[model samples]
Target: MFKNHPKGLAVLFFTEMWERFGFYTMIAIFVYYLQENFKWDQATVTNIYGIFMAGVYFTPILGGWIADNVLGYGKTIIFGAIVMGIGYAIMAIPTDNSYLVFAGLFVIAIGNGMFKANISVLVGNLYGHSEISLKDAGYNIFYMGINVGAFYAPFAAAGIKSFLMNNFGATLAQGYNAGFGIASIGMIFSLIIFTAFRKYYQQADYQSKKEVKVEKDVVLTKQQEKERIIALLTVFGIVIFFWMAFHQNGAALSLFARDYTHQFVGKFTYLLFDVVSLHAILFAIFGLAALLKKSNSSKIKSFGGIFTLAGLSLLIYKISSLPESGKISPEQFQAFNPMFIVLITPIIINYFSKLNKKGKEPSSPAKIGIGMLITAIAYVIMIIASLGLAPVYTLNGSTSAITVSPFYLIGTYFTLTIAELHLSPMGLSFVSKVAPPKMKGLLMGGWFGATATGNYLAGFVGRFYQEWELWQFFLILIVCAALASLMVVFTLKKLKSATS
Candidate 1:
């Protein structure tokens, strides 16, 4: 898989893998930790989780700016990694002070803001060579690396938490703290690997010479700068709702899993493996296959078919299995999106590459518009799922906990994953492709900043899961995403012109 890609790819791939390991590991259990340890209500916990996630994404603006103007990308990534590692370690301390935990989370968030976009910029830099024209394919490969870490985090977290709680004489809270500690271990390992490979990534280090030239040669007119800021603000506004809907994995959807889903495999052979995170493993296999298939035409086509069929089957099965009782653990449901990414990314990439070959590939803006529409559809799916389930509010405005099958959430995830494939990677690719050569790291950070804006709002939206009925909460998301999608479609021609 690394044969045609840059040597830096391996270094960055593992670095990102370990980073995600820590990040996802913490995320997998964040809500559970809040509820179980702090004894907070679901609403309070979701609110806090949303805020933390939002902050985590929000700081990238500063991180990106710093990398662009002051610190080089390499230094920024290193600083971010160290800070995140410390943050993860701090979370392991089992402190009673929520303020301290918040402080730790802030550190992690800032670090993520710095590291996430810069590293992606570095990866895109690797493809500067003519031999690898497959930037999308390359990102699909990198994304698999991300999921490899994501795939392991839940099981590792669940195992550590379960062990501590069940055997080590720790309370659920302590077990959670221990799980956070294990996540820190993953971070430390990543830091070590990154540092060791530092020499190999010398090329990824940011350069100031080009930036100096760009600054000297071109001055932005008042109107141009104003327009740029306005454009960013507009994009940010749309993203807030997108993230609010997208980030349910860590909040509402996770709670749904714990409450509604039948996690146990009942007489089904796949259940045994899936319960232990085999589903994630399947995702990894597909991701790896997608990466390797870039050079092999026959293999790409065969794998593409298999991937599409598998995703379709999963979606069908989940929809078909919707039950009246909503009792699944939402965290388990969180696995579906990444799993879907694993399955669909390759097929999407391949399909697009084929289209590109025939001069029929859609522009990035068009793809993003399509993504938003699909995201809207996903929420609609959830809204439908909510309809069959018991409504939280009745005629008297009284709320009741209704039992809805886990399938509702699963169906949403399946649809959302398809939407994610359309948007997230393409978003990253867009930033890499359009960013000025000298401003690559900073511009990439800007892309993450857009996502961060969404992430922050996602936290606030998560509160809805606690305050409103399932349908009501999901309906808001459907409308928001639909509007965003429509906006994208309306401006598609203009965006294409700008990027072109």
Candidate 2:
């Protein structure tokens, strides 16, 4: 999978993996921390969670601008990582003060904004226009790095918190704080990896320290620019609903896990997962070495392949060994989507590759539309599973404490992960491929801005969870996702025409 791509992709991949580890780690515990530690009500927790995530997505506009016009992509990313690391460090302070928590989140959001869009632009810059077909595959690989971190973050948080409580005799709040501290450490690792390997990505942007000089040189006619903008905006608008449906994992879904799901995994399963972490690190190192290797030795190349297969086989063995009757936590269930991402990415890429060879690959916009429709189906599954479940919260926003089967969430996450595979990475690649060259950074930021809008809507929709039945809430998401999918379908031909 890493073959034929620029070596810099490996650097970006690992860097993003660690960065997402920090982000998802903090996010996995955030809502629970608010309720358990700060004693905030559901409304408050969901509200803050939505707003914080919105800010995180919203700031990329500024970050992208800075990278494009000021510091360039590399510097902006490094700077963003440092600032976010500081924010994570502050969040680790274990305070009851909501102000302090929000302050920390704000800083992290700002830093993420600066880093997110520019790094993607850098990846897109790595290949020539002729490699556009490969761009989607590249982004999918990059997207896998994100899921790899996401896949482990909840586990890490759960493990760390358990360790602190069992061994150190710390309170749950303190353990959560310690978990946040570890998240900070993850960001530090990301920064270190990027800074140490900065030289590898120099050619991605035509020089390590320089910005793209094509902003003014490669001018487009008015009609071409307008059509490009329209196509981007169309995708942006359609994807808003997709994100609104998708990001529920952090808010509404998190609540479902806390209140509805049966969470009681056995000790053996937990232990196996813990053991897998060591292998995760070892595999990452071996993979990195393989990607970075300049040698042509067949034996050396085979070593990386062997390590990859060994790691994956071990992972499958551990998962299959888990007792079916054993329950796990809601947060632990967060791992399922990313795990699916890691498992399914190669299949999706191969499917698309075959389609490309046959000249029958769906256009990026069509794939995104299909993704939205798939997301709607995911919610539909949840609605059906939630049929008999009662509301966990009263109309007046009080807890009722009724729970549902873990399979409800597990099945939902599995379905939605497939949707994410179709939409999220495709959206990134589409932006990289279709956005006007001179405005790539800004337009990429626009994609996130749409996500920001969707995140805000996600929070808005989350507010309904407190007042509505679980099925009703999910039904509403079905409507939203279906509507988005329809919108994309309506524009599919025009979007394809414009991009083609």
Candidate 3:
């Protein structure tokens, strides 16, 4: 895979990987932290989580714009990295004040916003003249780097929490704070790596100039510009629902795991690595398969088949492990979605490559539509899962917190991961493909803006999981996503024409 790729790919990949390690490590415990430390209600915590995530995506628009017209990608990324590292370190400072935590989180969100879109734009620039041919594969490989960090973060955070709590005589709440500290350490490491490789970014500089030339050369009519903006806005409106449903992995679904799943393995596995070893194993198998496929197609195919079977078997095993009462820790299940991304991305990329060769590849719009629809289906699964549990608070006088099987949340994640494969990387590739050269950074930010919108609404939806029946909340997601899918499908021909 490295043979044909740009020399700068490794530098960017590792940078992104460590950044994600910090990001996911913080997210893995964010809601729990709020509950344990601040004594906020579930609804309030979810809303905060959603808002934070939204901010993370929203700021990228500004970052991308500045990078394209003013700052340049390298400088913007460096600045963002420093800000994020400082933010994470600040979050580690033990405090009873909610304002301080929120301030730290805000800084992190701003840094993320600046960092996220520009790096992708940089990656697209790396392909230069051969962008169309290489965009999909390049994004897929880049995505694997992201998951490599995401896959490990939870385990690292969980381990740190466990160690601090057990050995240092800290309470569970203090351990949670320690986990955030560990996440900050990951950010520091990311900064070190990025700084170390500053000299190697000449390729990124060369590619950016090419991008500027391409932007300057291409001209659009007033009518075309208007149409493009309109189309982008419409797409943005639809994608918000997709994100609202998909991002539940870090909020509602995670809560479900904490309330209902069984995380214990045998003594041996637990001793060597905490029970989070299961997540590490799943990620490893998937990541290895994806990276190794370049060497042997047959081996790749064999690994793909085995991975599917293994995932299915693991799901079964997790379901079987559930106690008679259905409450489990929510964080344990959060790993599954990233694990799914690691497993499915290579297969999906290869499948599309084959389709492209056959002249049968789906349009980007079609893929987005399929993703929205799949997200709708995932919500439907969650709705069904919610039906099994009674409401903690009822309209009538009587109420109870009923235990439901963990399978519902697991099944939802399973379906949502499929949807993510269809949308996330393709969305990134689409921005690189359709965006005007001068506007690459800005448009990339726009894509993240859409995500920001979705992420903000995700908080609202997560709050619903607290007040409404879980089924009702999920049902709302299903309807929202279904409508979004339909809207995209309706405009497919127009979008295809615009891109062509």
lDDT of 1: 0.70
Q: List all candidate RMSDs to the true structure.
A: 5.7, 4.6, 4.9
Best by lDDT: 2
Model 1 spans > 4 angstroms off? 1-3, 129-133, 208-237, 263-265, 269-329, 391-402
Per-residue lDDT tens digits for candidate 2, residues 1-500, read 78988889999999999999999999889888888897878888888888988899989988887777677788889999999999999999978887998889999999999889988988888877667678889999999999899888998898899999999899999989988998999999999999999888877653222434453123457898798899899899899998898999999988777666655655444532353744554575565467457764777777777777777677667667666545456678778787778877987998999999999999888899999989999988788767777775652443335556666777888889889988999899888877776677778899999999899889889999878887889999999899888898778898887656
Candidate 1, residues 182-232, lDDT tens digits: the string is 888888888888889887777656653344333212344565444444443
Which candidate, 1 or 3, has the higher lDDT? 3
Clash count, predicted structure 3: 13
Q: Score residue 146 of candidate 1 by CA lDDT.
A: 85
Q: Which tens-of-lDDT digit does each residue in 33-118 have in candidate 3? A: 88888888777788889889989999999988888877788888888988888888878777899999999999998888778998
Local lDDT at 331 for model 1: 53
Query: Per-residue error at 355 for model 1, in Å?
Result: 0.9
For model 2, the stretches where C-alpha displacement exceeds 4 angstroms are 206-219, 265-327, 394-402
TM-scores for all predictions:
0.83, 0.89, 0.86
lDDT at position 311, candidate 3? 58
- TM-score for candidate 2: 0.89
